[model samples]
Target: MTQTYSTDWDIEKYRDDTEPEEHWELRKAFMEAHKGNFSEEYLVALARTFTNIEFMGCSYPAAVMRRIAELSKDVAKTYRENKKTKLQRTFVSASNAAENKIKKRQSDPGVLPAARN
Candidate 1:
C-alpha cells in the first residue's frame, strides 16, 4: 500500500526561514521600486514589511525604517499644504466670478445704468 501526502504547505514557515542576506536583497529591491515620490500607503507597507523582516531574525537594519517614517511625515505635510493652497485658489476664483456677475447686473444695458450722483 502507498501513502499520499497533501501538496499544500505553510508558506509563512518558508518565509521565516529565509536567510539574512536574502532579506537585505529584498530590502534593496523594495527601495529601488519606490525610489521616487510615493504614497503614504506604499511607505507604510514597506515599513511594515521591514519590521517583519527584523522580527523574523533576517537582520534588516532599523535605521531604514526610521528614515521611512520621517519621509512619511514630510510627504503628509507637503500634501496638506498643497491641498490648502488649491482650496484657497478655488475660493478666490469663485468670489471674483461672483463679484463680476454682480457688477455686470449693476451696469446692465437692458435695465437703465446706475445714475451718477
Candidate 2:
C-alpha cells in the first residue's frame, strides 16, 4: 500500500527531530535579527521549545524555559491589546467617513426627490 504524506506532516516530523539546542540557537538568532518583534504564533512556538529540550535531567534548561514562557506570555498580551486598539480606531474612522458622505449627499441640490407622477 502507498501512503501520501502532506507538507505539513513532513514539516512537523522534521521539526520534532531537530535538537533543542539547534532550535534555541535559531530562535535567538531570529530574535536578534528581528529586534524581538515576532509573530505571536512564533513566540508561542519558541516557548514550546523549552519543553522539548533533551536535557530534562538538568535544572538550568528548565529555568531558562520557564523564563522564555513568561516573556512570551507578556509579549502576546501586549500584542493583543494593541491589535484591539487599532481595530477600534479603524471602525470609528470608517463610521465617521460614512456619516460625512451621507451628510454631503443630503445637502447636495442635484439629488432632490422627484415630484409625484
Candidate 3:
C-alpha cells in the first residue's frame, strides 16, 4: 500500500488564501546556509534535516495532518460539532429555498403553460 496523494489543494492556504507566504525557521536557515560555501553533501544533509521537520507525515497523506492536529484539542471538537451544525443549517436553508421557489412558481399562473380547452 504505497499509494499516496497530495492534499495541498484541499488545504485552506492552497484554496483561496489571501494570507502572505508562510515562513519557517528551517527554510530561513537553509537559505542562509546555502548562501555560504557548502559542500553538496552538506547541503543535502541540511535538506534532509529540513525535510525531517515533517517526518511524521513521511508515510501519510497531508489530509491526515488535520486529524492528527485535532487529536486531544478543544478547537478540533468545536470545529467538528460546528461543522455538523452548519451542514444541517445548509440543508434546511436549501430545502426552504426550493420549496419557496416552487410555491412562487405555482402561485404565478402566467408562468405555467395554459391548459387546452
Candidate 4:
C-alpha cells in the first residue's frame, strides 16, 4: 500500500525500519542547531581541528594547520566585521535588493523615471 505524505518540515518521512536514512542529513541538522550561535573565530578554530592533513616537511602538519587557521580567520574577519544580527541581515538584504531595483530602473532605457512633484 502506498502512503501519501505532506511537504512539511516537522513531519518525519520514514516509517519503515528497513529503509536507509538519507533524506535528513547530519550536516543540515548541525547547521540548524548552531545557526548564528557562535562567532567566526570559534567556528574557524573548530573547523581547523577537523582538518588534520600532514604535509611533506617535519613541521608540515603544524604549518598546514596554521595556514588553515589563517584562511578561516580571514573569512571570519570579513563577515564578522559588523556582526549584524539575523534581523539586521534581513533588513540589509531587503534594502540592498530595493536599492538594486532602483538602480536597474534608472539604467533601463525603456523604464520611465518617476514623476517629480
Candidate 5:
C-alpha cells in the first residue's frame, strides 16, 4: 500500500530546510577577508543582505549588524530630511496667511476687541 502526503505540507518543509542559513557567516567571512579593501558595491550588497536576514529573524554578528544598521539609519535620515522640508514649506505658507490676516486687522482700525466692561 502507498501513502499519500499533502503537496503543500511537503513544499513548506522543503522551503524551511532549503532556505539559506549561512548568510551571516558568509558575509562576516567576506568582510574579514577584505576588511581594508572593501568596495562600495560590496558594502551596499552586504548591508542589503544583512538587513534582509535581520528582517527574517536570523542571527548575525553584533559589529557587522551595527554597521548595517548605521547605513540603514543614514537612509532613514535622508528620508526624514525630505519629509521635514515639505512640512516646513507648509508651515511657512500657513504662517504667511496668518500674518496677512493680522496685518489686515491692524490696517483696518474699525475692527476692535470686545471691551471688558
Candidate 6:
C-alpha cells in the first residue's frame, strides 16, 4: 500500500497539533510588533489561536476568556451592522439569547428567606 498526503493536509495537521500556549505567545508577539499596523495575517492568526484554544478545551482564566468573547461579539456586531444579512440577524438573535441568559443569572435570587420568629 502507498501513503500520500497533500500539503494542505500536512499544514492543517501541523497547526492542529500546535500548542495553544505557543500560538498565544506568537499572537502576543505579533500584536506587540505590529501595534499600529494590524495586518490581515495577524488578525487571522489571532482568531485561529483563539479558536484552537477554545476547541482544545484548554484551561484559561475566566476573565480573559470572557474578554475575548466580548471582543469577538463586538466584531460580530460590527460585521452584522455593515452586512445586514439574514445570517447576521440570526447571529444577533443568538447573541441576544446568550446576553439574556447572563442577565437572568445575574438578576436571579436564590431561595427565599423564611419568616423571622
Ranking 4 against 5 by lDDT, winner = 5
Model 6 root-mean-square deviation: 15.9
lDDT of 1 by residue, 4-60 (tens): 333233223323344575454444444444444444345435744654543353444
lDDT of 2 by residue, 79-117 (tens): 346646763423458889888877887777777556211
Comparing 2 and 4 by TM-score, which wins?
4
TM-score of each: 0.22, 0.21, 0.22, 0.23, 0.27, 0.24
Writing each residue's lDDT as its tens digit, candidate 5 over 87-110 gives: 343345888988887788777767
Whole-structure CA lDDT of model 2 = 0.48
- Which prediction has the highest TM-score against the true structure? 5
Task: Flag clash pairs in model 4.
Answer: none
* Collision pairs in model 3: none
Off by over 4 Å in 2: 1-44, 47-89, 93-98, 114-117
Q: All candidates' lDDT scores?
A: 0.49, 0.48, 0.41, 0.41, 0.49, 0.47
C-alpha-based local distance difference test score of model 1: 0.49
Candidate 6 per-residue lDDT over residues 23-83, each given as its tens digit: 5444444334333333445444555545545445454678757855654553334433654
Q: Select the stronger candidate by lDDT from 2 and 5.
A: 5
Question: Which residue pairs in candidate 6 collide?
Answer: none
Clashes of 3: 0
How far off is residue 83 in model 3, in Å?
A: 0.9
Q: In model 3, where is the ten-residue run with the lowest total lDDT?
A: 7-16
Find the 10 residues in a row with the least total lDDT in model 1. Answer: 6-15
lDDT of 3 by residue, 1-117 (tens): 443333222112222243223323333334343433344444434433443333222434555445334321432344346546663423468889888887877777776455411
Supply every candidate's count of residue pairs whose N, Cα or C atoms clash at under 3 angstroms: 0, 0, 0, 0, 0, 0
